[model samples]
Target: MNTVLTLMLVAPLLSAALAFAVRRHDQLRDALTLAGLGTAAGASGVMFATVAADGPFVLRVGGWHPELGIVLVADRFAALVLPVALAIIFVVELFAIGQRKTAWGSNPELSGPMMGVLTAGVSLAMLTGDLFTLFVAFELILVSSYVLLTHQGQAAQLRAGMTYVVMNLLASTLFLFGLAYVYAATGTVNLALLTERIPELPDGVRLGIGAWFFVVFGTKAAVFPLFSWLPDSYPTAPTTITAVFAGLLTKIGIYAMIRFHTLMGMDQLGNTMLIIAGVTMIVGALGALAQSHVKRILSFHIISQIGYMLMGLGLFTAAGTAGAILFLVHHMPVKTVLFLVGGLIENDQGTGRLDRTGGLARRRPLIAALFAVPALSLAGLPPFSGFVAKFAVISAGIEARATPWVVLALVAGALTLLSMTKIWLGVFWGADPDRVSVRRPPGNRPMMLAATGIAVAGTLTISALAGPLFDLSVDAAEDLRDPEIYRTAVLR
Candidate 1:
């Protein structure tokens, strides 16, 4: 298990190094990127199998135990997210392979290396065990994402990437500062240790540190006030890059928030999360409604959807936490597919502006079908994964008797439906022949097929595996609610 986890982290970095060294060989570069991501995905599967059969697994570096050294911890929550992350990266990589000719053809060298590094960073972020290590992984992801966002070197891309860099660097600094405060007070950076010790700190210190951590992570997760950077930056990146970032990066921040809240003890800051969660939902949805571009609309909804995950965290019950976990797992893939399909639509039609596009459903029926599944699923339609995930969170809210939060969540769902349907009607279902066009050559069939396949598979995974996956999420929530299992495995 430890070997597999180590391989997962190293495979991409090693491939990245190889990619940089062999930059001129297009075939080799593409092969290395695919192979590296494939290996990481395989390693994720192995880690998942090991955890399913053997419970939790922890790997300590330098022969130092958890409290004394860096660790990589994998329990049910981490395990479940690992595969979803891998799947998103894998599909995006495949799409990149086909779209490279039209999309990244101008600067293959920059796009290739940056993407390898980005995939590696996501793998590391999901597996690192402590706050400091998580910070380092996040910075790695940020740097890689910056390069990807600005790969086109367009004026808009540069401006958006710069904003993204500035925002993330600030978040990284606050994260490091908060981690220093946490370590200075507790004398260790290990999450397992922090879980046991945070409760003993004075309320003033605890709340202060918790608040710093929340602001830092909230910024990264694009919550409420801190989310302005997201809409500006995300929609300008190359579609593939935008899709990957949309799917994984913010969720990594959300994952860290969940881990820290559980470890630091949620009781100390439940009310804070409760208030933030409500505001995030309302504000995010309203922002989504204001967007006219397809990517921008989806980007705004990302912030709103995050509120549901935060609501689960705020409730802090075992069930609420479980719902949050399930939502995170479900949301990442659904959002990724939506964004990728959006990219494909924009690529084929040459624009994502709602006013400029229409009648895609009649022109490209398959693409329309692919887009509808995740879009509707994201809007929380039943028999799809989104519905199941939202049901879990809303049910948990009800069970916890969080009436206001539940109402906010329900309203957010309705607004989400409105936002997605806005896209569907304006971009897909209309009949304005003058507003529709197709630029894809016959050779581009593979690209469309690849993107469509992924969207279909994502919808199927959620619908068919809902029962087992939700059960896994439940177990993960239990492990998180009681950190003894994690602590013992890591520290022993």
Candidate 2:
């Protein structure tokens, strides 16, 4: 188990180091990235199966016991999501390979190293245990993301990256402040221990600490009012980087929120999630509708979809929690592929705006098809992974008699369809007389093939494996709901 954990963390860092050393050799950098991501994905798959069958797996770093040192634990929830993260990295790296020259051409100094660091940061975030270590992982992700976001070295990228850095730095400060409070109150930073100990704190102190923690995590997760930074910052990064961030970074924040809610028990903060989830759905959808830029529109929808997950968390039932977990697994890969495809569109058309692009169906039928599958799936069409995941959450909502939230979710889904249709109609369908026509490059097919294959394969995987996957999600939710298993595994 320790070996697995070490491999997961070290592979990407080693790849990053190699990439830095071989920055001038584009082929070498690309090959190293592919190998690193492939290894991570393979390890994640094996670990997922291992945890699914044998229950939670724990590894204490440097052979230090869990209480005094860092512990890495994989339960059903972590196992399920970790593989999805790895898959996203794999797909995004493939897309990056296609766009490497364009991406690196923009900023030769930062692209390769930043990407490697970003990959390692995401893996570290997924694997860390205690709250303090989680904080360190979170900063690693933020700093790397800031660098990646500004990779272009353009004025807009710099400004957006700076805003992103400041907002997250402030969020990190709040998170640390909250952790200090929790540690002062409970005398421990171990998350599993905090789970058992948090309930014993005085109601007022618990509520205060919980609210502070929620604010910090909520900002990271882009919940409603705190989500302003996301739409602004995400679109300014290079498309492949944006795709990776869209798929993984925000999900990590949501992962933390769910973990904390389950471990600490949501009694004090459940209603807060309830209200925020509703607002996040409505507001996020409205934001998407208001955007005409493809990436910006997708960025807004990320927030809206996040609401679905929060709704599940707010329900506080086994079924609802399971739905949220399943949704997380489904959303990560699908969204990454969509964003990569969006990048392909931008690369070909020289823009991501719907108004300026048209006739893609006739000119680039493959890219058009790639765009359609995920777009429709994202709209929750039946027989697709999105539909299954959304159905689970909506059904859970109805079962819990949360009619208002169900209604909001339904409206949000409709708005999502509307927004997706707008993209299809403006970019893929109909003729545009205003835009200059461009010839398709021969190499475009392979890029489109890779992107489409990932999107389609992920959709099929979720649809075909829905039963067992749902079971895994439920098992994860159960582990999360009762932290004794995780605590015992990690602490012993």
- Give one digit per residue, the lDDT tens place, for model 1 in 1-492: 767988888888888889878988988987988888888889999889889999898888787877777888888788988888887787787777677666422266677777778777887777778878888889888998888888678999888888899999999988888988998999988888888888889889888988899999899999888998999999988777888889888898899888888767756688789889899988989889988889999999899989999998988898888889899988988888888888777876778988888888987888898888888888898889889999999999899888998999889889999999899888888776474455544235576567658656976787789999889988988888888877887777
Model 2 misplaced regions, further than 4 Å: 103-109, 437-445
* 223 Cα displacement, candidate 1 (Å): 0.4
| Cα lDDT computed for each candidate against the true fold | 0.84, 0.82
Q: Best lDDT goes to which candidate?
A: 1
Identify the candidate with maximal TM-score.
Answer: 1
User: What's the CA error at residue 315 for candidate 1, in Å?
Assistant: 0.6
Q: How many steric overlaps does candidate 2 have?
A: 0
Count clashing residue pairs in model 1: 0
